[model samples]
Target: MLKKLSGLSGIAIIAILSLQTNAFAQNIVIPVETQHNALVLQTNKSNNLNIVYVGPTLTDKKEYEEVAAQYRQTDEYTGVSNAAYATTGSRSLFEPALTVTHADGNNSLDLQYVRHEAKKIDDNVSLLTVDLKDPIYNFEVRLFYKTYFKEDVTEQWSEIKHAEKGSVVLQKFASAGLYLKADNFWLRQYHGDWAKEMQPEESKLTHGIKTLDSKLGTRADLFQPPVFMVSLNKPATEDEGTVLYGSLEWSGNFRIDLELDNQDNLRVIAGINNHASPYTLQPGEVFTTPAFLSVLSFHGKGEASRKLQSWARNYKLLDGKGSRLTLLNNWEATYFDFNETKLKALLKDTKALGVDLFLLDDGWFANKYPRNNDGAGLGDWQENKAKLPNGIASLVSEAQANDVKFGIWVEPEMVNPKSELYEKHPDWVVKQPNRQEYYFRNQLVLDLSNPQVQEFVYNTVDNLFTKNPRLAYIKWDCNAVIYNAYSSHLKNQSHFYIQYVQGLYSVLQKLRKKYPTVPMMLCSGGGGRVDYAALQYFTEFWPSDNTDPLERIFMQWEYSYFYPAVSSSNHVTDWGKQPIKYRTDVAMMGKLGFDIVVSKLDAKDLQFCQEAIKTYNNIKPIIWQGNQYRLQDPAGNAVAAVLYLNEEKTSGVIFNYLVNNRYAAGSERPIRLKGLDPQKRYQLKELNLYPGTISSINSNKTYTGEFLMTVGYNPDVKAGRASVVLALNVIMENS
Candidate 1:
């Protein structure tokens, strides 16, 4: 009943069935259009669709179909490796594409493929639907792949519709099952902890299954960031090499599995966490999974990353208003000890340091219980009258009088057991009916799954904004992940994870609509919720609580691959013994901010800080909105460098950091920059006034972009720790 398609290679055509010359050939060739390239799926002799080519442009060449039908055949029929609706009892033993639990408790989905259809939903979007049905149970599923031609990304998810006389439960369903060649394929993932997030890890793909998942009910947990990439075993440099990457646009528990089959075919399965998740569907009911965005790049990992970054900035993330503001957060300056006078003094120093926004983080709320510590007053949103008798309005007024914007911090999704809100709505927290609640960080997560609870959270934030009309920004922090995951109102307890995220999304959407102008940031104690889904709601993300520039070089390098610089809020913290210029240089690469005590620095250090802030403000437009390139791998080398170039290639900046490592041999290496118009000549110079503290280049000179990229710029890094910032301007265009 099935033909075996064989002879598939890296860009090789698979032949399953011999087709006679006919007009129907056009129907067999499926072409998906995207912003950067086209993905062509051609049906072979097996009557199944397989990817033939994914490249720069769409082609209707007849030879593509002919070659697809001309490949060698096999005797055994194990079904196609790239099964659109791979089900139970199939030849494949990896994760099933669809698992349907019948009313009789039998778990099997025997689907027979019917046909495939395509539709142009919009000028910039195309939709492909593959139809499959179970012959015995009358269950049907439409696997969908939507492509945004301008975003250079494809999204996949499935919609299941049941016509069975009885009910069925959808146990496991993957948003996409991408099949790729297994020859020398490598998997790259980002792993780290609370302070050190987005650390890149790479390994070669071997036999068996390798999975990356987040089950802590948070998307970007301490162990894993919500992204996976695969490239050739020998990856090319930043500008060249073929790579493929995918990410789930969900903030809740999710899983991504990569399995290499016996025939050396790699299958990537990604969707919601199905470990304990099961959705029951009654007769005439339907279920749909969240989309999994997948991108392919023939050029290199950098190109693939740029595609995702462009899509995120242009469509997903909040639109920017020119350059970002240099903010000064008071958390590090005075932790819970500041009053009106102290804060006023800090504001004057912040204004003197060229800070445009003043953010007052945690410990400013609560009247019944002091929020001086994390153990009390989390759910309380009122300003502490004892700490600030003049109230938050006066603080906002003070900031405005100093010509700086004002912002406040809040953790609306969590509650302390000692708070008034928790005492009144004890049942609102996430906990089982009979089990004792286990608190994380002395705080219990509010059950946003409940609609009434969501309304309360919304009102709390809305009232805060209503009370303080001058509040221009909000630091929305979620310090703890959901544990003891149980919702009292939901009977299907397994759906708690899914419903909790939905409720959180509802609250965020409501707040975004109510306060369109005020930008809110996403922070999960630091970098836990920094995913594409969260970016749609928040304007920027705090990369980490650890502001050590040495650690940040690797963190920002991996983080910027999928996200633009504007999405990251980097702060210069006063880590003991670290130089101020080194910290300032690291933070200036992204959305620069100061998390140190501005009033405590000496006159010399303060002058350096003032000059650094001015330099960042002058070049922030290129840093925030430009194409970034990791010039050197910070993890592998002691000398790390990163370059940012604007769209026009007229201006750019490069930051070089030399770490103090015993493994470092004190060898000087040429740092080649990328993302430049090779025909143009550029002039590079160090931005700082401090002599010999930070070296810009081996030779202070001008060179063509081609020579800079090919010949390279070597920075004079001493044996000790040091950092330098280079400002580049276009001098001439050879073209």
Candidate 2:
């Protein structure tokens, strides 16, 4: 019998029950659904679980059952097409999600359906766990699925347990495996290096395996973030096709494999990369993989991104719904050469610009091995008496006097060879027993895998907050990559990569619990540590070190496809020769900040910056909590535009940037806006317009949202005047 619980806002809550069978073959079906999406799993007569469907919600249970029945395999070759968690050495031949060598020397695994359970965590979320066991060995695997009803997102992970007397070698353990059947598949991936991060690359899937992975154990996201999107039957677009997207919640070495089988089914397996790191599970021991979050959208990549952003803000990120403070960092301003007097002057400038927070970046620490440059004083956390005679408390007091908050930067996970900390604990760093040590930025990675190192890292933050209780923010940086990859504390060095991430997470979790409200920014040379697992503890992330405005336009555009703009710290720096207004306009797309020396700004530039800050404060709500639409792609056109529409579709903002004018002959075409209420009228106004710049559209005109969305307005941009930001508000009528 099918029973229904009381629903919430038209969302049906179906009771989980197994259908009875009179014959020998038993059939089971489990439907995990949110408001907008559904993931249905079914078991065939052989007791093998398979994913029957994963797409928009199928409200009719009978319809989905019929769909599942139609997919019953009659041939052995196609049996693995819809496998829920394919394993090695079964009848399957695909890339297995779980691979283990048993203690008795058997390498093959055949998992059978044992039982399952489903429960609601709250009104907005539900969890489902399916238990599977090997018919021969004493090995078991439990797959978990957590669905967010309102956000239309599903999170999946796996737990493996062994009951054998000896130990089992686990080679591959994927968090989640998804199977989709489509006529054609197009994969969109984000990849880049150092300052050039989050660059999007799209490719069509053929009959082979496509792998995206990271071997940089510590700064995993330096080359690529553990996230991707796949469009069905067509090239990916912002708002027009069926798209599936997912992201891994691990900050260590991870891998994503997209394999297109001969049966025209695309299988996606994602989890921690087991490259040269095979874990051993003892008797009664359980190993759990990190969560893999995913969403399926019928309306296209735009809808998928909006759902993910909503989930991240409402559930995953720390204080994600709150607005970020507009900060000014001193890295580009003074570099590593500032004292109490210079810093207090910078605080006055910060107050003059109306910035909320002032960050004292590097160079404020160490006495014997001062951080005068990037080559020293990384792990040492004590304030340099020579640089600031009164310590960090004096700066905090000065910032309070100027009505601005104080923040400081620290690279706690790195140690310079010239520092006292490394000399004190030589074995605390990650290095092979006798091999040569490789250095990056003249520093080595601290072994977070060791408990002593974890304690030291935690105390570094505790001491800062204890000494200066009014410290408003912290910029935690990791400048060194894992080069030696060896941990002396562990009996098996193969566990170094996984244990190091766990150790880092342990330290962050403690800090988050201690200082529940302090905002922290995660930076790893640049966007290297921008994964969800780390974001849970930090408030925002520095997207890149290169603060060039033109480069940021394209970089932030690609970043917005997955992450929310509110958590991205974009700064206006002196890296490029672009105009002050142009630089400010680009940085305004995300959490606004300034990295240049404000004291050196000319009179006109200073006035423009202060006014621009005021304007950003007025429209930040729309940028932070709204649906983003890529009106134009920078890769395909000379001019790129982006629009943000509030939840109610009442007010919005649009920013357009001119990349180059050499091939911009037809760049004056009016771009059709998106996500607007057709019945209302909007008044448009230009903001932060450069002096003497010609307006592309009539800024004083009022147009119906229907007309604005269909016909649109031209963004006439030229080389001299490179960018424009327009604000739109509802034109209220006399009701």
Candidate 3:
């Protein structure tokens, strides 16, 4: 049953295997809006390691009801995950208790986790220990996790992590691999009880950022950077990699291999023109790749990633050049009536979108202007002047005489009790200056550790970037949700969980170190501050303002498992209530922008948004640089695509999508392409059902291939929506 509890051990290892595996096992069924559900885990692997989880008895950490409290009920009331309710314990929520220790002898493995402390939130008792070691074995199952935050409630700690965070390439095992390290820099990064402040002579200066194979040359594909520890001497709490500051800074590492003799449960990868190929795995064979994630730190190990390379010469993305400028967003064309000639006709449609950013969100400096629904006059940043009687530096010099680049929108960490900055700093907000003040969206938060409200939200973005030098993209919105959880900059409530995540990482590292390269994009109310450590200094990530293409295929397949489609933007909306070539082919696999009214799109949806913006800028140099393959199709789930070839195979782009309505009568479904050019031959084009009939495809496995070929994306036989395109021809062979 998990392979007869994988190769036994024990007192015969828990007396003849936990009384013959859960007393002749049986009952283990699942269903109910589940995303992932792996856990048959019961490992103990030879040379006597250790094991014990037992199960249930959570006792309220806030009525965290159950995960496995008496469970043998298949959907007996949508069984678990009411968002796994738990203010305290009973975290089965996707079980885990794996153990793998190897040793030919000379033993030591007394590992005893034993968690049964029902509501242990503050009376504190959730001990997690890892002593893993192995030339042979002391502990090394090495990979298996689940928990994307369960509860911190001001660090009362009911934690769980891993529902997405990446570095891919795990299990091929031609040798040994994998080297995770999380003692948050060996022992503490703003969390507490580093084994009770290990005074073994304290130390600190750990900065990090260097692996992909020594700053760019690559080699890592075994299980992954799994030692994610953060204890900055205990405080800042929020899991899924929350780099709290002041100490401990353990770098990152996730290397892979050691496919413990591959009993292959599946691992077929290569698709979209290595033709008809898509599916992946090898770690109980899972499958999923393409990772750039916001990894705040990870400089080495996995044997310093075989001396890495490729940081892409000074990692820059869009250039108007640092502190650049081109802003104008009135929520996709005035959601609130603006007075100044409909706000100078959207700054004359923002000087014809050529650039010079002009932003003006949330009906301007409140006081019942957009006719107040909330936030009455929000810390008064002035100039409503009857909704702009030519003020705000005359609409910032009428958007610098239409050259464009003006900004405005401030929740200034909120306050709105009908306004006047909470009738004058209602104790500057996050109360305990005596009871009651916690409101969610109607608004309240402020106390930015109070340095006079972080110098009034930094003198209101430095007096609008000191009277606008074309003030750029700062769509830094946060609409609100972290309720009344007080924090007058900490003294209690368990030291306000490291000053509420060090006061939102100190106003986002001082608004990105005083606007370094002003191309910000971390909008909250939209994909709620899309994660991956707010992409180390936010460059771009809106992912969801809900541009709906069948709700962006599970929101861009759950943010393309660890984001990076040129930091993902995807807008192109003008009301395609359903199917506009399947929402511009799911916004041409990212970095594809547009928000309606190019004269309300019609000439065949404006020639399919100009051939989906010239097949997304002719595969914008391989969807902004390639090697992204995300497919898992073994004649199942009919199809879903995300290919991005380009490790010098000249170029690539396979974006495919087609949810199995099954097509066998005249079957034609080949798609096995990934990082192609087994010797040049591609040129395929379908860029949104255009002038069809093009195919060249070639590739015969550099790691996988059969090189498929079958095009007929249903569009009543073409020129309306079905698509495909493959292009290679770059083989400068020199080996």
Among all candidates shown, the one with the greatest TM-score:
2
Model 1 residue 665 lDDT?
Answer: 44
lDDT of 2 by residue, 462-505 (tens): 99999999999999999778887899889988788999999999
Instruction: Order the candidate numbers by TM-score, best to worst.
Output: 2, 1, 3
Count of clashes, each model: 4, 0, 67
Judge candidate 3 at residue 29 and give its lDDT.
22
Every candidate's lDDT:
0.77, 0.86, 0.40
The residue pairs in collision within model 2 are: none
Native RMSD of candidate 2 (Å): 6.4
Model 1 spans with C-alpha error above 4 angstroms: 1-27, 35-38, 42-60, 66-76, 89-92, 104-106, 111-125, 320-323, 661-667, 691-700, 719-721, 733-735
CA displacement after TM-score superposition, residue 157 of candidate 2 (Å): 0.4
lDDT of model 1, residue 185: 76
Q: What's the distance in Å from true for residue 601, model 3?
A: 14
| Residue-wise C-alpha lDDT for candidate 3, range 1-735, written one tens digit per residue | 445545544323453344344334443222110011111112122211221111121333222223334334234221211211101012222211211111222222222111121222223112222212222112222221211111110111111111112221211111111111222333221111111110112233143321111000010111111112222222222222223111011111122111111111111111011111111112232222212211122221110111110111013233211222323466666555567777777776656644346567765765542334454665666667677765677777787788766766666666667777677667777755556665655676676655677778777767767776666656666655444455654443432322333455566668778776666665655554443334456666565566766456555653443345656666656444655666666776665555544444456666655655555555665654455655433124445555666667665666655544435321144445544544454544435553343333324322212232222222122222233333433433452
Q: Which digits, one per residue and each the tens of the lDDT, describe model 1 over residues 1-735? A: 132223233221211122222213544766666766666666544444455555556355555555434434333255556665567754545667678788767776655445688899878778899776654455778878898786678988888888665888878877777766535678898888889788777888888989888887744566787698888545645767778888988887888888877756677888888877787788887777778888888777787877777777776787643345679999988888778888888788779989889989989989898898889999988888888898989988999999998888998989998899888888898877687878778988888889999998899889878888988888899888777888888888877888888888899889888886678788998898877777788889998888888888778888888888888999989863568878888888888889888778888788888888888888888888777777887777878888888889989988888765565543377788887778888888878555335443533467888998898877665555467778888886463
Candidate RMSDs in order: 6.0, 6.4, 21.8
Q: Residue 482 error for model 1, in Å?
A: 2.1
Using Cα atoms with residue i matched to residue i, what is each candidate's TM-score against the true structure?
0.90, 0.95, 0.31
- Model 2: CA > 4 A from native: 1-23, 68-78, 663-667, 690-697
